[model samples]
Target: MSNDTFTSWENLVKKQLKTDDINAVLRKENLEGIDVKPFYTDVQQPLVNLPKIEESTHLVAKYHESLEEDVFAFLLNENVENLEQKTIFVNNVDLAGHISPKEEVQYFSLIDVFDEKNATVNDQLVKELLAKQFKRNICIDIALHQNSGASISQQLGIALAKAKELTEIYGTEILEKLIFKLAVGGNYFFEMAKIRAFKILFNQLSKEFNLNLTPYIFAETSLRNKSVSDSENNLIRSTLELAAAMIGGADAVYSNNYQIGNSTDNSEEISFKQQIVLAYESIINVFEDASNGSYYVEDITKQIAEKSWTYFVETEENGGYLELLKQGNIQKDIFDHAIEEQKWVEEGKIKLIGVNLYPKLEVKKSVEELYNNTEIKPVRWAEMFE
Candidate 1:
């Protein structure tokens, strides 16, 4: 049977099996799960509109215009002055990488030091670029390095330290207006809670320095959890991640084109359409704080804040964040956590639809092979550091 036919059959079966005694059945099964009631009583209805948290005001401009000549020219003319108004977090630095150098200069520039030889070249590039124009914000993704080998604390420390260094170099006056783009992974609840915690931490940090800047968050579905085999399942994976981002109050989210993992045009169209559907068709934007009063979400937010704050304190105690990074403590922490998470996935404690569970028909694609075929280079922060 076709997938759609199977889905329909499953739905019909589920309807027939529906019962007002679902909670009782779950109790017998010791499931401790959410129960469905046959009907809602008027007394149980909500009385007031819940307080709303402001949504992040970030925008992700992944695809600007088509490659067709006439269309590109028209779009260019219309966007020439306002190009910097949109900035998308990029995954690779290859020739075919989403953002082109020409487009980078035209829309947004780097927010790091530009002096190639300076240890702080990344910071300098950002500062220099910000100085030239003040139209829209630019991204300096130091966090990408943390994905493969660095610790969360180290990533946080580096990002925080870099922002501080830039503020000092550029002066807080101009720094107040710049946006810092953070790349998050597919840790689901943890990722969502992390963003919320960062907001609080950033505000506290700003208060200490008497700087009044609110961060603009741009999140992208992680590439780390994606697998080359069963590439089609990436759609469901990214969809969940994107939903978490939106619920966590990301100003903007960019769903990775699935084929991106293999450097092919494979599922780019579908992935992009997924995001568009969520925004326009799905109407997810209709309500703010969609997860606001949820018992689980609220509890997780508190837990994450407490843990992250404890880590932040430890960083402060260890001669501050940057000092800890220089000693590689940050990297070690991240590595350890990654190892634990990998184990969880292996043991079925953490489920990855395609990788750990619901295994797919085998089809392999190597990063090296994909890179070679597409002539794309992954972004490497180590090179920038060196």
Candidate 2:
């Protein structure tokens, strides 16, 4: 192990370690087709083509009716540079009232904020919404489809369709107004790669459209991982997810109550406070582009981007976004991915802390009580075990 004996890590391995020892370890591959090695000794140069994720990450808080004043206080006290607000409205009236000519909120749903069936904007309100320069341009919430059922790659492909269409119709100007909100799950590396993959794919599509625009992005904790039984554990999930959002280079990340159908002030407050801790107390923000040079992460980002591009092209070839959805191609793929994830939970391969791995010895709520009380969607992952 002399310093002079080390030329490369591989050379050191060969000289100091026996072949039998190295050969004994097994490699695992993820759904992204990335092979996980026990140890990575052969490091590659940073991927020059990829982008570095710097944290201009804003801390986002959910606007709650029960804690409206408190939530507002959180926002008013929060540094403008580090905070943004997400107004979760059940109807258009709410959205219309909440929207203003000027506000510091980073993102919210205007497309379908009123109702699920009629997601389009009305004629009269268009004038008001268009009157002001929003914090960003059109909002494409990939998290909505993701929380509904889309897989990592599916989320990317779905988002690409929206980006391509918007950039084509609106041109590069839309880029300045573009904002993508993604749902980050618990798979640390995969989630980080997910954001990177979408950025790369969108960047390429922008080039094809002859437009130069960098995506403004952020993520919310995945509803898929939230458990009603173990409410405290959901805080842990939020913490990890927020970390993933930071590592993935989100411009800002927000937290929401994971009590699922039941939005308690307790859960909401705990989740909201986690953001304050992450940005103010934790040094995770100190390293921007931390995963930029990793062999596995860079490789996975490229792979996910490639696969996502294939889906995007195929969807366009078949006739574009809405057409694919009409043909059930979009729904079918998302459903299939959701089923696969559900299978993992059912089989105990994916563990939900209070639901599966550990025995609660009793039910937290009746089966019906657990179903969504809020219009915000609940995921199939936590429900599978129940």
List TM-scores for all candidates, in order.
0.64, 0.77
* Candidate 2 residue-wise lDDT, 1-35, digit = tens: 34454446555575566554543444553445555
Model 1: residue 332 alpha-carbon error in angstroms:
1.2
- Tens digits of lDDT, candidate 1, 1-386: 56797667656655776844433433321011122232222232221222223343232434444422211111121223333424323322231123333444423322333221223335544544454443333454543533453434444445555556555556765545545555566556556655665565556567768875455555666665666556676677777777766766666666666653465443655665566567666566445556655554555455555555566667667765445555656545654554454444445565566565675223233222222211112322111111
Question: lDDT scores for all predictions?
Answer: 0.48, 0.63
lDDT for residue 339 in candidate 2, whole number 0-100: 60
Backbone N/Cα/C clashes per model = 15, 5
Give candidate 1's root-mean-square deviation (CA, Å). Answer: 10.6
Q: Assess the local accuracy of residue 115 in candidate 1 as a C-alpha lDDT between 0 and 100.
A: 24
Candidate topping lDDT: 2
Alpha carbon lDDT at 126, candidate 1: 52
RMSD of 2: 6.2
Worst 10 residues of 1 by lDDT: 69-78
